[model samples]
Target: MARSYSSYIVAQSKRTPCLQNVCQFISDDCRKHDCKIVSLEFFAQDEKPRRTDLDQLNLEALLNTDVCGCQGRLIIVEDLSTAVIETLGSCLDIDPLFFASQIHGPTFDIVSSKPSDAILPSRALSQNFLSVQYQRTVDFGACSSAPRKMLRNSNVPRKIVLLPPIKNRSIGLEQQSCSILLSTTKSKPWLGLILVDKPNSDKYTTSEKQLVLPSTPFQGGYEDFSERPCFFEPDSGSPGRVSLLEDLVYYWEKERPPAFQPDQPTLLSLTYYPLKIAAAEWVSYVAVISHSIKQFEYSTEATFEEHGLRKIDSDLRSLEVWGRRCLQTSSKLQSAISFLKYQINGAPELEEYSLMIRDFEYIADLVTTYGRRLEIMVPVVTSVLQITDTRRSLKEAANVTRLTYLALLFVPLSFVASLFSMNGGVSAHDLTIYFAVALPLCAMVFFVTRLPTFDFVPLGPAFGKFGNWMRKAL
Candidate 1:
């Protein structure tokens, strides 16, 4: 038997010309973009996934077939092409603007309902668009071919520095962007499209690679490359690690499924993972910063002991960079969480997904706490740095005071010697006369400089009383 579109879509095709027209549009758009569907799966209430290769699937016959009872569908694509966006909009009866927002704008999470003037009413009245970032270990193989110069020693051991977010710098860490589109339709089960844009090594041009600290995120590789795991294999009996997005679509496909899909609301509950993961990253980042601050103190003390109070302007600069990075990342995370909370609460379709509501609320609270923690660290870091600067200044001042003491003792002796060397002075060979004049002059100058009134006294009480008498004589 030949494979076909999901039963619900086929059934709806017979009743509504709008869905058929949308399917036709998807086909036309797909050809225009030269796009290929990575994978497509259809699910019914109590049946196995009717998975098929969408690239070879015919879109025309899909509208003529008659089938029923599709509870959900999943489409996985490597790129967010125009065709994918339009198809999602048509299927869920949503505005394409919601799905396209992340493309041109910044990454964020938003939930939107069908506009009042939408042509078709959807059973799933709301749609969710999520854009989240996740950290991944650098792929050295992919990065090696990039236009950027690789470190001389490929395996050179270097300490991972998070202050500058080495992960984002194409160093030891990489951040991948995951854009998810989730919705359900009157004719289809829960539908989800995931577009994971891996960091392209070629995205960074030669000029960008030369920067000591690039202003923008570093592109991992600069060469032509193909993204991997474009399609997530459905979990079989073997245990495997599935990401939250993958877990959402293939939940029922798991051998020991954690929970059955009660309805589309249940699917909404899974949306919590993105925000939760983001918050968790924030907590981890703050923890790293706190530890780094402690390390900064210890290292500074050791540096002072070994190098004798050398200036650490570089360390201060690094702290400033870390602070700015923290604020920028934290603000973004907060905005994303706040927006998600507001949209989810106001969305009528999500009323049944109570777990999702609570999850986001908890995330909001935790983010608030972590943000405060980050803020508190600022003063503590500043204080530590301030103490270092003060110590350096004091050390410099102490050296100056010792030099002043030497100058006090030497200046008068030097003056007497100069007089003896002149033609008008007694013979230079007259050692007795030279000692007689130089010793007294040097002693007088030293005593006057050490007098308490002049505030040069650094001796005991014996010197103190003598110095006070000298001050009166002066």
Candidate 2:
């Protein structure tokens, strides 16, 4: 017995008339070719079926007459060509070259030439269609061969070639889309291959333009290319494409040389790597350089006290000269000291390394002036104390001299008064006057002996302890 096979064309459509007409045309064509006409299933608008689960349904049996013995083939004919394209593109298992040959007209030649890997179901093809069934598996080899033959015949100004994505282990082609966009809209018509993985899954959509470089002939090899992954957003526009040539140029300019140049062997191997990787390494190198500069600045700032002191001392000399001029007047000396104190206590600006050095120099100047003055002032203070002691001694000596002079003047007077009182005439009254004068003279002697001598002491341990205690209290 001869084996019987069946073919089924599964399609979805909103427009009933167009769906019915297309189904009838396909059924008539199958019969003319000596194939048995199974059943024509018209899924009306009310019978809108979901396409997602269409593969699992008894679509083959519903359209085929002899189910058990039939070898089945499914050909989807839809009014929405774009939607049909997109739906088929998303089904990874479905080979698009098998059905793309059914599209009518010269456009079929160009469409057929496109790599089967590039075929993507378009959103427009999802709207409306019909389904047909037959008893044999569809042969797509003839359809696959037509695309390459078409490319050979056409002298189109721009050519778009789509190649599969690179795989780590396999040499076989991966799914991809390629199209050429003409720079001059009039020169060569734009060609597009829309690829869809799923309604919402990853879709590969791309556009390319041809360029003629001054150094190269137009007939040479196609160099300029751009590609992008496309997705449908509810209201958003299409996806953008990145040019491979442009990407290469950008990475080439951005990449930096290694800090330490490697040996020739390593350098030659590095040249084979992608420019993006090289650029990343260059960025990392620059970051390290910047960090090192900061570290050096910090180290220098930390050692500013040692290296920066000389500059500070020079400024200090000027401050000391000013201090000396002001010191002659006590009030100005106090004002100068207050200013120096204020400067030391206030915060300094050291944001930049150079600024920190400048500030250190300023500080050095102030310290130099203050340091020198402190040294000179300490000895001067000692000398002044000695002079004060000498002055106190001289004052005490003068007081004693005065007391001696007073004693000389009053003793004779007192004696004379007593002598007078001793005389026989008016003796009682004279004695009373002599006693009053003698009493005042003794009081004066007592006061002169006690007052000035109280504070005089030798500079020894006791005096040193007393001085320290005084300082602490102050």
Top lDDT hit: 1
- Give Cα distance to truth, residue 321, candidate 1, Å: 6.5
User: By TM-score, who's the top model here?
Assistant: 1
Q: Estimate the Cα RMSD of every predicted model relative to the unseen true structure.
A: 11.9, 37.5
Report the lDDT tens digits of candidate 2 across residue range 1-474: 532111223242122222322233334432211111111121222222112112213333332233332222122221223323333334322322333323222222432232221323342122121111101001112122112111101111112221111121111111111111111112111111111110111122223322221111111212222223245534322211122222222322233222212111111112211222222222232232233223212121211243344433433443343344223223222322232233233434312223323433443344344445544544443444445456667778999998876765675466657777667686667667776767676665444444332233565566555555543442
* Candidate 1 CA-lDDT value: 0.44
The TM-scores of all predictions, comma-separated, are 0.55, 0.18
Kindly give the stretch of ten consecutive residues in candidate 2 with the minimal lDDT sum. 130-139
Off by over 4 Å in 2: 1-351, 427-474
lDDT of 2 at 64: 29
**Cα deviation of 166 in candidate 1 (Å)?**
9.8
* CA lDDT of each prediction against the hidden true structure: 0.44, 0.28
Writing each residue's lDDT as its tens digit, candidate 1 over 367-449 gives: 45544555565565566557766776788899999997887677777887787778565655766888998999888877576
